[model samples]
Target: MQSKLLAPYEIREMTFKNRVVMSPMCMYAVEKKDGIVTDFHFTHYGSRAVGQVGLIMLEATAVLPEGRISEQDLGIWSDDQIAGLKKLVAHLHKSGAKVGIQLAHAGRKAQVPGPIYSATKLAFSEKYQTPEALTIPQIETVVSAFQKAVKRAEAAGFDVIEIHAAHGYLVNQFLSPLVNRREDQYGGPIGNRYQFLNEIIEAVRSEWTKPLFVRISAEDYAQEGVHLEDYLMMSRWLRDQGVDLIDVSTGGVIPLEAYDVYPGYQVQYADRIRKKVGIATGAVGMITTGNQAEEILRNERADLVFIGRELLRDPYWVKTSAKLLNAEDQLEVPTPYQRGWR
Candidate 1:
């Protein structure tokens, strides 16, 4: 049977060749403090493109220097980084894959030397740094940083731009009541907590006309944390803000908690948000096989399947999946690999 996983998906003007997406997984390969793309990034992403992954979402690239999760993470904060990013995008395009970059800020989670910043002056753990709470003006500056990063992404020729609002990052910090303890308009109610993300989206829209995505940690896993219902409201707000899709992920608001985890564990969150909010969503986490990916799409659980660790283990996962599902012809095998496929 033909694989639904191999079907084409279109968001905005860009058409993904298949439903399989390489979820952004950071490779701490940058060799300089400048956070430019190195040969490792080119080779890493290039191999996935060559293996026929439909959309390659590059890892969490910081929008500001201090926002980096680590010193080795990629950055889009400078004009000098554009050329290297453009080169990577160009190669991925040549190999028949759409490309995206996850624009992010680690917030209090940043392990770098400088002052860490968060919505509240809270540290993720005893070992983590106590972040300086952003003043109102400082918050605006962060929003501006996102705007500038969008401009850089446009200049770098990315097909899609995903805002990293999930995984206990900067935006997630503001969204969760467990951390955002501000009395200002930026805190208190859920609507107020959403203010930071709302402003960033608006600012990004000003400079970006292409397809935009936001990765949100839908379920914070704590009793006081944001839940699936909260994410439904968040997804609705995102759709209204001109977001093309929501990459659904869960947890990471606080220190890790014990939860039942298995294959396609997060697919339920994607299904719920997509149905309730009436917006496209992507399912990620523990989704390893082509059949599992196909099942999600066939049932209309999500618009796309984001494969992470599986792809890290095997860059040619898409191709191998095509063969497993007897849909080998759906993916274009390189001339050199034609013999193996035959």
Candidate 2:
């Protein structure tokens, strides 16, 4: 009656209560000028923690002001934002769930009326200007920004810090052939494309003493985008550099024109990457069932499965899923709701 997915697991100095983690979904709630964490963020994340998730990952929190996905995306550009974030982290930790922040940079996707990206000079079908390519000095600044964010995240009491290196954001753009047309050290070969992520990982690790996660797309899901072979190579490099988990998600390079994305379609990539890199991983995308999740864990396909939209739809989905699979003892929901348990 018990499912392994509802069981506890350990990764890099911390033990999660179970395998259920809240995926970082953008709320776009932060205002333009102020980068402070609002009460809205506290409530949004705290509720899920109270609902008994194993880990709670905050949305793509920008490392710099211009790196925001949109003007509303959270940022840790200044030390001032730490206090507000601490208040929320305290709530999650007190509720017996661990918390992490997905540190990100939108890169070429910066500055939009909304969250958007255009890496190359050629837009999909519209006229657009190419972004002012980041100079070596600017790149260094960003690396420092990541380090500063990690320091703040630790100060705010996060249990883990995941570098948002995938999904066609800044780091992904540098790695994708479709976006990066640079003739410099950051572009060209797979090694150079991987250099940026490695540098960020090295810098972030210096300040972060906890588990460091790097989320990556197994494939850009485009024949022309980053291929699986190169993705695997990059993932291996990350493992060598000391990443705790390779959170696997795909298809943010351009768009998927011919992807066969059934439920749990991306799980195979997590399986492949883990076997190849010999590193722990978190599987995501279209994973909705407890049975399916347990199968991923049972087969050793992934170390963890992050539930996104499903968690949004049902905050207490974990308890319901545990019982449906007859694994109720695996998790402890609020005692006040004890009568509701079957």
Candidate 3:
């Protein structure tokens, strides 16, 4: 049965069936009204639940209306949306998977007319318009939105709550000097720049009792964005503040080759963040094989691994991966479905 050590583990009060996680991917099927998730969300997340991944982080859900990446993005700013998200958590739990929600704000990335949003703006191009910078009150509102959303997630029965501080989103924007040129308290050197994230984490930490996770861009890939060294400094602070894990994923801070990135091109960030922070880390990006995943775990580079596009390609990738890892017997089959794998 492969190493049982890799089978199930616990942090805070939630236990996952394995180290593999379903990295959040947008279905772009969401239908929201004044910032709320609709029936489509339940069906979409519910199906992912049945796929048997150890942990599932919902996509980048906006915390406010103006913060939304697009018209169809899921949101968590109201009670109606909370009800639907709760239903998702219940369904996923019954399906035998722990659930997580990724709370995000698109910052200058907001209000894109399509299903996807990007950080900063393309004002220099004839095709795009630069966004209005958020005011102090607006920043405070976003902070509350995240706190409220996280509380809603707990009420909705989510086992984990991952703060989306990566991908050049709101928090990412603040962390990056390139995008955030504000002269106020939220900009400047590392300490001042991290104020936004620190406040959000502190607020969420005060209100949330679950295993708090943070997804971060180890390097913004540009000299102006948050560099790897800054992450080392910031990650230590995150650990001190009671963050359980750092979801180490890169890019989205600056545009780079998305399709051409080689396997584990970004894994180095994961390794460094883990060592620098001394916290449990989740390595994600270009990871595609059982041995590769196993090697990461064996070398202690990361405590967990998240598989994105790969899982979308094979819902039962876990079963196949177990076979490749020679741990087939650990498969937790439902009695009715045992015969298939047998």
Candidate 4:
């Protein structure tokens, strides 16, 4: 039987060979703290391309130095960083895998040295530093940073550009009502809260003509936090702005709550967004097996399945998954590994 998960999926001019995506996960391997790609990054990402992942998305890359999640996180804030990224993209392309990067700003969640910026002065927790509320001029600076980052991403030859608006990051801080207590233009009503992201998208779209994606924390898991209706509204705006897909993940907009965690736990959010918003979605979180991923595609739950830790555990996960679904013939095993792949 043929595998739906192995079918090619297209968005704009980019076509993915399969439904499997390497979900962006922070490696924290930049030893120089200069935000440049190191040898570890080449080996780490190249192995996955060799394993045949259709779309390999890089981890949260800072748009500003202070926006980093840590000193070791990747950065795309400078023109100097482009060559290394370009080389990485070229490496992946040689293996027939498309490349993507998540443009991010850690905001109040930043664990770096300097002060972080957010919609309000609220800190994520007692453990985190209290962030300075972004002034209007400062907000504009942040938007410009995203625009500059998009230009850098384009120069690096990325097939996809995903704005990291989820996980309680700078953009998420502006999106969630519970955290953004500002009564200014960037806060209060939903439209106002959306203004920050709206500006960033506009800036990014001006430079990025390829497939654009926005990762969102679908639910806040807090009673008064962002809910489905809020996300739907935001998603509709994203659609209007020409966003290609919504990478749906739940929680992480606030402190952890006792929510059930299991395989496919987040697929429901992705499915709902795809059906309700009439936009494509990528399902992620604990999705570990071939059957699980195949079901998501065959059932039309999501257009893509983003695998994280599982890919880290097995770089050849595509081959393994193909074997599991008895669809090994669908994947072109690398010439060097063909004998062992079977």
Those runs of model 1 whose alpha carbons end farther than 4 Å from true positions after fitting are none
Each candidate: how many clashes? 0, 0, 0, 0
Over 4 Å off, model 3: 4-6, 32-43, 112-126, 257-260
Q: Show pairs that collide, candidate 1.
A: none
Q: Which has the better lDDT: candidate 2, or candidate 4?
A: 4
Every candidate's CA RMSD: 0.8, 2.2, 2.8, 0.9
Best of the two (2, 3) by lDDT: 2
lDDT of 4 by residue, 72-168 (tens): 9999999989999999999999999999999999999999887888989999999999999999999999999999999999999999999999989
Stretches of candidate 4 off by over 4 Å are none
Reference-based TM-score, model 4: 0.99
Worst 10 residues of 3 by lDDT: 116-125
Per-residue CA lDDT of model 3 for 1-342, tens digit only, reads 365324787888678988888898766666544555567766666655665678988888877766677767888887777777877788888879898888888765565653322223322123344666667787787778888987888788888889998876778877877777777887677888889899899889988888889999887777656778888999999999999999988777555655347887777888898887788998899888878888888888888889898887787777778888888777676566677886
Query: lDDT of model 3 at residue 253?
Result: 57
Models sorted by lDDT, best on top: 1, 4, 2, 3
TM-score of predicted structure 3: 0.92
Please give the lDDT score at residue 59 for candidate 3. 89
Q: Relative to the true structure, how large is the alpha-carbon lDDT of every model?
A: 0.94, 0.83, 0.78, 0.93
**Candidate 2 residues 1-342, lDDT tens each?**
568877788887689999988999998888555677877887888788778899999999988877886778888888888998898899888889999999998876566543343334434323332456677888888888998999899889999999998887888888888888878888888888777888999999888778989988778866678877887888888888889899999877664457677999888889999998899999999888788888899999999999999998888878777877888877786777678764
